[model samples]
Target: MATVAHEILSHIYSRIVSPQVKELRKYTAFSNNVYGELLPTFVSRIFKELELSSHQVFFDLGSGVGNCVLQAALETGCESYGCEIMENAAELADKQAVEFQERLKLWGIKAGSVTLITGDFLKIEEIGEILKKTNLVLVNNYAFDAELNGNLVNMFLDLREGTKIVSLKSFVPPGHNITAHNVESPINLLKVDEREFFTGSVSWTDAPGKYYISTIDRSRITKFLNSQE
Candidate 1:
């Protein structure tokens, strides 16, 4: 109880929002519609579409509220991890993971535990370590953070089998999907996951925009990640 409380407080300190961020971030981008307490049914359905496994690793970048990680742990029996940079937000993720683990044990659920790291994804060295344990990477639709997302995507793509990357982009494309710095390639450089029309509304990727996933190759998931250059 004490540990969970402390972890919860850790998140209360790090995050700052304009109106309301009372919910979890979904997809690889950690985006949401109606933005509050877990993602909309639309995003969840998209996850179902992916059909991940227990042995593989699932990572959520910018894991707000650590909802996806908790969900992953509960459903897949796979190791769930969240990457958060905000000191307060990261703290919240850690606390959430702890809570989820406790709940799983109490229920005798055969789910996986989560590891939430507090740090910027830009730190290649640090992210590399996380990648070592990761099999599936998720990206939400926050296009502004595309540079960091791309770097992470590129890194994860380099791995081999048992490794898969999923980048969630807003279907709108123009709004949050990160711009491909150069014309050479939108996907070539970023390795975005396949785009899925998650929600019926245009606001799939938080803030009323379509949502899509920039997924990585399934066959080369682990191999590519292990062979990172």
Candidate 2:
């Protein structure tokens, strides 16, 4: 039997979202670091891997048009939040969110709450508060610069233990080591797992790439401290 979520989301993509995306492509040209999208299949895989559920809260940093946010809410019944800094993209996301709500009524299906915020995620005080309670966070940091990635790491420091963060680029460097000198670094608190995504998983490129799942484990810091003692 086809799940209610699958049926509704299929209809929404074919009827509601596809046309808007087509129209958007006519005028909008995305540049590096400004926009990218993960396909629905890829997102579904992520939800499965993370075991997302109704009891959790999901956040998307640098969300482009709220695709992942909408999917997370409707499919998992998890409260979903997305923040987009680009004005045009944010406006489109707002419109899509409105339509998404109305369409859910037509299907007589209930979905989790969705909140779309338009602003610099790093500067948004409300987002900081929400992050403390968020169970999972997604950031499409494929094109993000080192400075921006560093800033994101600082923000992740406040995430609760066991919170998982998904990103296109690994926040913790490949060869990172927690020595006494850098014991205070936020990287020390994360345990990252790298995964491969084949071509067509993302909108930016046609080649295969890697993504990372970073779980906040304060125990790492504790272990380091205990070793010192």
Candidate 3:
């Protein structure tokens, strides 16, 4: 039954996602490359490697189709939330969440709930309210420039200690002392805990795409920033 349900879900996904991606591409203003969905395998890897459980609260900043949050909710039964700036992408994500919720019920699984917010992540007034309680946060910022990345790191300062931040790129090089020469936009808070090359799909292609995953240290956030000053 599990195998049959997996096959059914695959068929449903292939049918729905092609048109959804097409419709979203027509409306996305940002670089489409950065807006692709994280593969299911990658999401599983994240949960397993991090030892995440139902006790965690997950947030996906700049969540494109909200796949990360959806996977977190379904796999770990974690409280998951996604913030998307693109309206079409947000709508598609909401639709997918509803569909997946129904499908999971058919498989006798009760997925954790998900919330999709359609707005700029930076402008979300409830970010602090969310981040304060969050345990894990995902950011797909491969396309973000230095300034925007700096802004993101600054915003993360509000997260409670012990929260984890997973990002696609490193804000700074690892094993280097925090000297002025090593400083990149004064993001002294986020300490790099892990860096690895991960393989995943992009744009419905069979060809594999390579991306970096970096985990940040939240416990040392404030202390590290103050030491740097």
Q: Top model by TM-score, which number?
A: 2
RMSD (Cα, Å) of model 2: 2.5
Clashes of each: 36, 0, 0
Evaluated at residue 92, the lDDT of candidate 1 is 61
- Model 1 spans with C-alpha error above 4 angstroms: 1-40, 124-126, 161-163, 170-209, 215-229
The sequence of per-residue lDDT tens digits that candidate 3 reaches over residues 18-56 is 677667667435553346666766667777777778888
Ranking by lDDT: 2, 3, 1
Show the lowest summed lDDT stretch of 10 residues, model 1: 12-21
Model 1: per-residue Cα lDDT over 1-229, one tens digit each: 2234224333432332222244334233442221332353443454466666677778876666576776666655678887766555565666656655565566455666677777766564766776777766666534445555445545654554445555444322343323235323324333333444533423333444334454343533334445654
Candidate 2: pairs in clash = none
Per-residue error at 222 for model 3, in Å?
Answer: 7.9
lDDT of 2 by residue, 1-229 (tens): 1266656656655665566665445433434345668877788889999999999999999887788888999989999999988776777788778878988888787889999999999899999999999999999988788888899999998899999999999999898878899998888888999999888898768888899999999887888789999
Name the best candidate (by lDDT). Answer: 2
In TM-score terms, candidate 3 sits at 0.80
Off by over 4 Å in 3: 1-12, 27-34, 173-176, 179-186, 201-229
Worst 10 residues of 2 by lDDT: 24-33
Query: Which ranking of candidates, highest TM-score first?
Result: 2, 3, 1
lDDT for 143 (candidate 1): 49
* TM-score for each candidate, following the candidate numbering: 0.60, 0.90, 0.80
